[model samples]
Target: MAGQAAQIEGIVVKSTGSWYTVFDPATGQRSRCRIRGVFRLRGSRTTNPVTVGDRVKAEIGADEGDNVITEILPRTNYIIRRASNLSKESHIIAANIDTAYLVATLDRPPTSTEFIDRFLVTAEAYHIPSVILLNKMDLFAGPEFREIIDELAGTYRNAGYEVLEISAKTGMGIDELRARMQNKTSLFTGNSGVGKSTLINAIEPGLDLKTGAISDYHHKGKHTTTFSEIFPLTGGGMLIDTPGIKGFGLVDIAPDELARYFPDLFRLAPHCQYYNCTHTHEPNCAVTAAVAAGEIAGSRYVSYLKMLEDDDKDGKYRK
Candidate 1:
């Protein structure tokens, strides 16, 4: 059957622009494949047509080195953000993730609430489970810093999210992270300098993914993990590692729907005076009242407003 096209099914483990590394399900063989010219992501304006964690069908010829990916199977879910180059378009980070672990840090390039909230909103929009991983806990040496970290952790945990305080350098709480990732395809994402790669190495040693130091001058993480790649966790799961994100602009979501993604806000939305309250200037707004009454975190309310600002007609936060 040399003349017959050798069709095979596999999952895309790595995406480096034009070439994709797909792993064979049956034989565990990896084939470097290129997308067929006519294939495109349906209803998507993303830069890359395919991303890591996507199941695909490819035709392997006599030389498996140059297989052509013919089709992408239906994805259960995918996480995306605004592409850096294209303002209107987006970039799919990873697909079919059972859980998205957001790695955050309190010092040496601290993670902001706006970034965390935007990410959580996106995850909420896609119905993907999100877990917050607070790395660099060892840096919380002083009682003041420890209080800040503990308060931040409490804020999220109260919002119905699972927050794990970890220090990859010291292996603190890495085991718990591993246990949570067991038998699940988890997407590890975070801002630069938040220790995403270091945590991965700690979770599964020898991978030694190239990691860079946080720039002391700028206090930001230097870009590492240039492309999206998936690694099989020794604990019977998959972890997709993504490049450090500087910003996570929401895409494919509308302004009116933003409040619904915030669980705490949504719960109080129905009690507002106006049925179509924007929660900004609307009188007797339950959301704002909750924010004032100390029932909701003021930082979260600010994040919601920032997203709303981006959705404004002349909003400048789109990027």
Candidate 2:
């Protein structure tokens, strides 16, 4: 047996860089540990070597100090993104997520539609069921605000997803959200300042996740929650709250295959000509035609193309 694999069995509840905080279920002890060098890089394109929600076997040191993670069990599914260093590599966000909650805000943070679409496409690529939660319903006091919410909720629902408008401040729609989350390990993700931490605090008060305000100058958000950490919900399931991600760099997905991630694009791509249409300039391209005829959102096709171009001509992602 490897020297590192001789200790305890536990689930990784937190991951920062290569350091993981694993909880030993048997003893209920959480130890901060580093993974074996074998797992470092090891051909993973992501910036992070390990991810939250990993099932790992940890070995506590002789002094009962910091432990070392010896092995990582297989994950059912994981969400990954491009590394932030602009190296064209990837980073594993979270693993073994039963469901993902796409939290967005209309008033304070104003989550972009392109961001939501890109995330949804990525979720589809990972085979994760995602539900959109438009937070801060209490702040949308005007009719115009309500109309936009309805339209967004309707758009996602029409795309074969479940969307709900909730007020983490006023407790609106929190019950339904809680019901759906019962007994499920859910991952909450969105742009910064979209009230992700606030909503989690409202739902599971004991979590006490740090929350930050949206930047008024850049009209963006600042990172409040640092590192990804999984918290056990008092109601039953687990919720993983990740740091506010400013950019969601997609990883590994090739350009030619990018359309497959978009449900609407995939549904209509088979009709294009040339059997392997790149959908750029190919004649009789159903995707291009759809774009021209307003069948597909131009923004989405552009985002797909961006992903493809970012993949480089080598047909792989690695900066």
Candidate 3:
């Protein structure tokens, strides 16, 4: 007891499965910490007990090296998805985020609309504000690419999301992105090859986050950011950079409640004849009517139906 360390509060800036890097804002010091005891969330089984952006109570020993995280503070909100298509456990991408910026690309390992929808749905379920950053705008020189980007932006805009066209390689929309991220905790996530690390590096070049290249043969991005870590931005806020996710599988959301998460569909659900409409085959379904009338994007409706079917079949909705 003579050499025991007192309890101190800090933020978990990085998690590498077995150890966590806890940063104390008071002292501006980071200590390598390990879990002091078994910790688990009430109803869910999470793969990692501690994740980036989590505020925890840790003990820094007298020598100031052997730090042990004792507790994880309650999270205001977090983004979660199934750990895998076959695993029942959920993985929290980041906790207590002020904004979630999903970096998407239309070419070179294109980010599918379904994948975007899935991410938005998860954000909606968690009540987190989401912005779609269409990176690699410099590639849209031809009219064909321009049209595609325009349509994609319009689709998300019509659904009540702000879409920003950005080219990370050329600093096209980095200023606006920097302003938006100022003084807030922002999470950047997307499929591999979407340039998440590149964008972050551009936003804060001093960070010099590692960037990877796109595979020529497969047109996929090799993983560069292996673990989640939080960085202090020079612009007065924090950022949580996570590993590039290949698929986002829905977790903890029921089939009947799925529509509520899709903002476009949820707006039209009330007009349906039945109070509880799956929006699949019920007569006078407002959602179906909107889809047929071209009020809703056909691709979004397809994604919704696909999620429903997946949930109905095996309760595993992966995209």
Q: Which candidate wins on TM-score?
A: 3
Model 2 per-residue lDDT tens digits across residues 5-113: 3489899998878578989879889888887768875845556667898898888875435578888889899998764426677778899999999898885788877
| Residue pair clashes in candidate 2 | 45-90, 46-90, 46-91, 82-249, 255-308
Where is model 1 more than 4 Å wrong at Cα? 1-4, 41-44, 84-86, 314-319
lDDT of each: 0.87, 0.79, 0.87
- The lDDT of model 2 is 0.79
TM-score (C-alpha, index-matched) for candidate 1: 0.94
Error in Å for residue 307 of model 3: 1.1
All candidates: TM-score: 0.94, 0.88, 0.94
By the lDDT metric, which is better: model 1 or model 2? 1
Candidate 3 lDDT, 175-268, residue by residue in tens: 8888878999999999988999889988888888998999999889998899999888885999888899988888877888999998898999
Between which residue pairs do clashes occur in model 1? none
Runs of candidate 2 with Cα error greater than 4 angstroms are: 1-6, 41-44, 64-66, 312-319
Worst 10-residue stretch by lDDT in candidate 3? 310-319
Name the candidate, 2 or 3, with the larger TM-score value. 3
